[model samples]
Target: MALSVVDLYRDILPKTNCGDCGFPTCLAFAGMVVSEKHPIDGCPHLAPEVVERCNQELAEQYAAGKWTKRDLAEDALTWAKERSASMNLSDLPGRIGGELLDTDSGKALKLPYFGGHVIISEGDITRADDRELTRWEKVFIYNHLSQGGSRMPIGKWKGFEEFPNTVSKIKTMAGHVEAPLVDRFHGRLAELVDAAKRIGGMEMTGKAHSADAAFFFRPFLRVPVMLLFWDEDPADGFGATAKLLFDETVIEHLDIESIVFLSERLRQLLCDAADEAPQKGNT
Candidate 1:
């Protein structure tokens, strides 16, 4: 007879009860493995051969669980609220092509004009002037901004800086890489670069471009993407700017090739944007 999970644990798992796998005890891990909540690989003691067998068993269990289609009871409003909190607006202004939403006031006001004809003012407001973003462009910005936690924009507005300025940082990060995982990453970077050029209309300097280049190419490549944009006056000319810095662990893994790839891709994007909109002045 095949060994039961309990039987396998009694024979195979180390009795040491280490929390290496985060479970409190070997027996608990064993039980969880059987239920498919914990993988067999979590057991440090099983000989590799035994581990493989356990993995196979767990895979079968996982497949069976999938076929059963588990039902979950959930509160609809809570779900919606949780989902809304993850919502992205990076490209919403460009798509909607009207105004930016003021988070505090719950009102949408026209883009590019701030505090000129207003009374109530506290939080920062962001606006995008470009009116020509494709549907996919909008979604890419929205999803990456909203759903990609911690990477979301800090706030839409600051005292003087607004969305048009903020989007440029999105533009910088967007150029970082063409992920081998998907063709969309390449296409999206192109669209972001173009949209940024068309809308923000900023002619970034060699130094600014170089700094952004370092992020996508070397330091940023190593990090597990934590994109946070905020306004900083690192220097006077770099005014009311968006700066992106990643987690340290990610920077450790970067290689020169990654930097080169990022640089080439970014250059292509910038050149393309230049070709598309020669008239717009640099922001």
Candidate 2:
């Protein structure tokens, strides 16, 4: 197994939020070291020997493909929430293209999620209806805010394989993200399009396009995802495939793990919506 951020926090480096490593907290520093390949020796509290050992171990694991961007869960959420909370929520609306609303509790920003909205305050994020989000969902949103991305989408699209350092995640995106949708909507292209539109995908007319269907989505201000579906043709022996394309600018807004997580969640939402839409085959 790869060296995990949680393990490194628990084992090495004095657990002090000393900010000696140029991060706000030790957890933040550890996450940077493990995930972003920040030098492990940046923590001033670590002895030279300790840094040497960790550097050698991490170097080997990373070279062996054991190190990849982690989900940044649990304590990661803690650090992310703290980091986001320190920002001025009032300024987040312009920064993220979110709508600020005055609620009885205080103020919050309503950001688009799938086809719906999620309200994020300084303390926590909730669905538009005030329901709690899963830890991963919360963490994802917090990390987005922590990234502080503000670039506008350039409109060009690319596949997951186009990004740098995405080799470890290409299979994951295929198996978990694309394959599931392909399996679910194989013979149900009509249903798939309906679900996608219902969940904020704008149907795109295929003009001289080889793809059977295409749709576009702006899951975030800077992060736009395009879906290209090629329905199976039994006569041609072609299997149904769903390929998700991302804006070339997505890397600036989301890390690898978060982008994959976003896709998985989007697939779930699309599948759920398709189930609820009137199914032609159901009758």
Candidate 3:
């Protein structure tokens, strides 16, 4: 079988967004390569042996007409479906922190989310309110189905840097997720708190750090995230800062990329909520 462009790209590149490849992110560079706009050599960090192997794989895939990116999500969903199909529905509730319920179609697992309840059965996903699941939501479900474990959250929190294989992604995570929040809500604790609460976040008290505000978000059943923000103090010369933490088991539920995606999405959600909130001077 021909290898996927995503798989091949992952194998060839250094997975670092060094910007020497002329793209903001390595994933963007991979897209360009898959579309044939750039060659694999565009990435300067690849070792010689890896480059040769990737070129060989890319050649075979091109010859086989499997160089398209259109079916990447579908392929991932199919893979997750296959994994879920082999598991017993009854056991999923305990394993994935979901609640199993009987539906007209059959047994299904219901996991709560910020938007609504997500129903999963045999690797298929649907919303409890009869709405269609978004592409990101589907991806989250696929990841949960494949990576979720039977363990529960132990209440211990660690930052993204603490997660396994995530050191290289720390810069991206901070730039995309934490910086945006700090930029938007700096010194606006009330607005930040309101936004967090609107998005199903709970305020955490008595933290050891000097964080002005801390909120916990559960974007998925098994994925718990904690965000802390420290307001800027000009007199003290301390600029505003934000830090996001997750359970140690988070790595077992989603890859670093997916976790980053979730954080960015949460940032957007908070920004939207802040915009809709009533201002002090507004009517």
Give the top-scoring candidate (lDDT): 2
Tens-digit lDDT track of model 2 for 219-243: 7776888888898989999998898
Model 3: per-residue Cα lDDT at residue 40: 81
C-alpha local distance difference test of each model: 0.38, 0.82, 0.77
Query: Model 3 residue 119 lDDT?
Result: 83
TM values, all candidates: 0.24, 0.69, 0.69
Q: What is the per-residue lDDT of model 3 for residues 156-252, given as tens digits with 9 covering 90 to 100?
A: 8898897778888899998988899989988787888888998889888445555788888888777888888888889999998989999988878
lDDT score for candidate 2 against the true structure: 0.82
In model 1, the clashing pairs are 124-157, 126-163, 201-282, 201-283, 202-282, 202-283, 203-282, 217-259, 222-250, 223-250
User: Which 10-residue window of candidate 2 scores lowest in summed lDDT?
Assistant: 63-72
Runs off by more than 4 Å, candidate 3 = 1-79, 82-85, 280-283
Of the two candidates 1 and 3, the one with more favorable TM-score, higher being better, is: 3
